[model samples]
Target chain A: MGEVIVITSGKGGVGKTTSTANIGTGMAMMGKKVALIDTDIGLRNLDVVMGLENRIVYNLVDVVENNCRIKQALIKDKRYPNLYLLPSAQTKDKTAVTPEQMKKLTSELRNEFDYILLDCPAGIEQGFKNAIAGADRALVVTTPEVSAVRDADRIIGLLEANDINKTHLIVNRLRADMVKEGNMMSSDDVVEILAIDLIGIVPDDEHIVISANNGEPLAGSDCQAGQAYMNISKRILGENVPYLDLEVTKTFFQRFASIFKR
Target chain B: MGFLSNWFKSSESSSDIAKSRLKLAITSDRAVCSPELMEQMKNDIIKVISKYVDIDTKGLDIKVTRTELDDESGTVNAVLASIPIKDKRPFRG
Candidate 1:
């Protein structure tokens, strides 16, 4: 059966949708059949982020309401044959879909896909509840800000309270230069405060913004953030890929030399 | 004089301040005590202790906080309270 993982953050604008898109694409690039579900019903943006918004004829509510079959609502990404997206409904609110419906949908999806990723909405409300109902694991994304870290701690507590114990932390948007100058909190500091296992860290990169603007995810791109997402995907597939060193920007020669050491 | 004072002062980095503040905030968030429950608990404690001694009720301070264990194994959520006694009650035998 496929693993259903939910990417969630209690606060908005902390890279939950972006991480879901990249990780699902990264897994698909490794030849795994992946499905990305956007659970933010009223404020759906994963379709746009994945560049599949134009092809979304049917959405999550349509499938849940039995107005269309699951296959009809699933939008296949052209770049990756193995990747697909289940876009959210912009007209309907969070109350339109219940947790029981989400559970049934994800259980049905597990039979066909190798990995099912749920992009959760912000806050600890019904939207968050529906996204995590069928999830076997959770990835909590947070930046190096006080508000994000505080919300992350609350998310971890809520996850444990709900018995979703296999949760991991993803520290995103880390600035290594700021960390070196002691102006920003490092991933180590975040992990220590959150007291959870670190899966991966993505540094702040302009490429991420550019990819989002162009409606393309950073999969197989020669960027540090892209490499970090691919590393996270390999780790999810039970591969022991060491984390990319973001302490300093390495030259092409140095990176090439490190490949030989591996 | 401003430059000399600035050089003499030990400046704390903003990241360090953020870390310490976050740690403090999380510690309280994990303690999980409602304001009403805390107030009821304080009143209960004060009522029971008032029979033994005269305490300054307004001076009572109580809060749920995290602290390290004596054996240093790990930290735990502890209810720390400080109450002042104005006078001792007469012994009734």
Candidate 2:
């Protein structure tokens, strides 16, 4: 059976959808049959992020409601043969499906795929609960801002209370320059506060937005953030991979260029 | 000589300079205990103790501490607190 993983965050706009797409694509690139499930029912964006919006004829709700089969709803990625997406329904609310339905859907998909990545909706509401109900593990995504970290902490507490302890942290939209100037929180500070094992640190790369807009994930390229996502995918597969020094390389070059200009 | 003597006087309370006020605030916030309540409790303790013995109520100290719990057992591992009490005065036994 494939491993079911849920990518979630308590606060909105923390790049949960983006991480789901990139990591799913990353796993597919590594020759794993990966299925990315969008659980953000009403306000779905994973389809657009994955550039599969135009191909989504039948959605998750359709599959659950018996309007279509699971294979009919799954949109195969054009670039990666192993990657597939089960888009969420944009017209229906989250109540259209129950947690038991989600569990059944993932369990069925688990047999045919190597990894099942669920892109969870924001907030600790019904949508969030439904997203995580069928997962074997979870990835809590958060930004470095104080408010986001605080909300992420509350979500972590909730997850632990629910007995979902195989949780990992992904710090997204990190700005190294801001951290160096002490204007933003560093990865170390976030880890210290959240007290969870770090899985990935994706820099605030505008390329990620552009890639999502173009339906291409940065993980397919050699971009720093893309490389971070790839490394995280390996780590998820139980590989002892070291985290890349995303800030050091850029800062060192910047300092060297400044000295030369002087 | 005057400048050196002034430096010594200012440096006498180095503890006051090194201690952070925000750290104290965080400790209080984490424990959900207020400084005002702590002060009142200290006063009440001093009053009760003086009634039992001729103790120097001005020389007592009370503080609250926090501790972290064990990770595997999900138990609190550390305790952090602040306690306030009457200052201890060196005097008769």
Candidate 3:
């Protein structure tokens, strides 16, 4: 059976959708049969982010209502053959699906795929509850800002209250230069505040926005954030992959000089 | 006028900026203390404590500190408030 992991955050615009697409793609690239589900319902954007909006005929509602089979609603990724997406129903609200329904759907999907990634909606509402129903673990994504950390802390408390203990942190939109200048919080600071195990730190790369717009995850290319996502996917698969050192920035000559000095 | 000016200058002593706003907010959130009620309680505390002891009214500090009561349990927490009293006794030779 495949593991079900939900990518969630309490605050909006923290790149939960982007992380979902990238991490799903990363896991697929590792030869895992992965299915990404958008649980945002009315605010569905994972289909557009994954660049499969045009291909989505049936959605999660259709599958749950038995209007279409689960396999029929699954959209295979063009870039990675192993990756698939279950788009959310834009016309329906979060109340259209219950947590029990989500659990049933995921349990069935778990038997067929190696990984089922649920892209959760922002806020600790009904949508959030349904998103985490059948998940074996959770990935709480947040930025280095105080507000994001505050929301992330609240989400962690809620998750713990719900008895979801297997949760990890992913600090996204990190700006190393701002952190170095003491203008923004560092990954270490965020981890300390949130009090969770760090899984990944995606840098504030403009390429990510552009790539998402183009329906191509930066993780498919040689971007730093992309590399971080790949590393996160490996770690999720129980690999002892070391975290990328994002604090240090070195030019080619500086790297060579450091190598010689060492 | 000069004495009043000196008094005012002395009253404006530099102190460390309060860096515990977030901590205070978190404590109050956990404790379910409304901001208005918290202010009133602080004033009442100052009024009650002043009757017995002299406090540095400007330097008066009343903050809620949370500590884990135990390691085995997850919901273990305690809130404590610290209020320092000024030394009012005259120096003895």
Candidate 4:
């Protein structure tokens, strides 16, 4: 059976949708059948982020509403044969789908795909509850900013309260240079504060924005952020991939440590 | 003047400040009582304790913080009560 994982953040614009797309694509490339579900309903942007917006003839609401089959609502990604997207309806609000329906839907999906990733909406509302209702694991995405980290902490508390015992963290859009200068928080800082297992740390890359705008996920590529997502996918697949050297711009400890290894 | 001002300024960067602040915030969130509630409890404890003994109110520190009681529920907030005495009383062993 496929594991159901939800990507969430307490605050908006922390790259939950982007991380969902890239991780889904990376897993598919690794020969795992993956389905990306956009659960944001009214503010659906996962389709746009995945560059599958133009092909959405049906959406999540259609599947839940029984207007269309789940297979029909799923949009296959051209880049990766195993990767598919279940887009959310633009016209319907979050109330269009209920937590019970989501639970049932994900259970059905668990039988078909190796990974069922839910792109959760920001904030701890009905949308968040529905997204996590059927999830066995959670990945809380956050930036290096105080607000993002604070929201991530809040989400971790909520996830623990809900009995989602398996929770990991993804720190995205990390600028190494700023971290070195002490202008921004480091991955260590975030992980230390959140006290959750660190799944991946993605660097700040211009290609991420470019790929999002162009409807392409940069996974399985040389893009730093994309490579980070790929590494996270491998880790999720039970691979012991060592973390990337994304300790912000400062390599003081790393450099100091490497000197001894050499 | 420059040396004194530099000495007064802490070496903690903004990121350090953020980590410390977030740690405090999350601890409070997990705590059962709010800041005001903790404050009231502290005052009440002080009032009751001062009925028999002279204590240093300014030096006294009490907070509703985490306690290492149960390993599993270590995050559960608990009260830390400490009161300093102003004078010592003679005792016979």
Say which candidate scores most in lDDT: 1
Off by over 4 Å in 2: A248-262, B1-68, B75-93
lDDT per residue as tens, model 3, A1-262: 8999999999999989999999999999999999999999998999888899999899999999999999999999989999999999999878999999999999999988999999999999999999998998999999977667778877877787688888999999888866764557778777765667899989998889888879987674787888999988989988998877777677889767644542
lDDT of 1 by residue, B1-93 (tens): 545665575688779999999998887787769979999999999999888877899889988865658996544579999999886543544
Lowest summed lDDT across 10 adjacent residues in model 4 chain A is found at: A253-262
Question: iRMS for model 3?
Answer: 15.2
True contacts kept of 3: 0.00
| Model 1 quality (TM-score) | 0.83
The C-alpha stretches of model 3 lying farther than 4 A from their native spots are A247-262, B1-24, B32-77, B80-93
lDDT of 2 by residue, A201-235 (tens): 98998789789779888785878889989988989
| Local accuracy of candidate 4 as per-residue lDDT tens digits, B1-93 | 545665577788778888888887776666667778878888889889887787899999777654445666435456776799776872323
Can you give the TM-score per candidate against the true fold? Answer: 0.83, 0.77, 0.78, 0.85
- Where does model 4 exceed 4 Å of error? A247-262, B1-10, B44-77, B80-93
* Chain B: TM-scores of all predictions: 0.65, 0.41, 0.50, 0.60
Off by over 4 Å in 1: A249-262, B1-9, B39-93
Q: Which of 1 and 3 is the better model by DockQ?
A: 1
Ranking by TM-score: 4, 1, 3, 2
Model 4, position A198, has a per-residue lDDT of 96
* TM-score of candidate 2 relative to the true fold: 0.77
- Candidate 2 TM-score on chain B: 0.41
lDDT of each: 0.91, 0.81, 0.83, 0.88
Worst 10 residues of 1 chain B by lDDT: B1-10
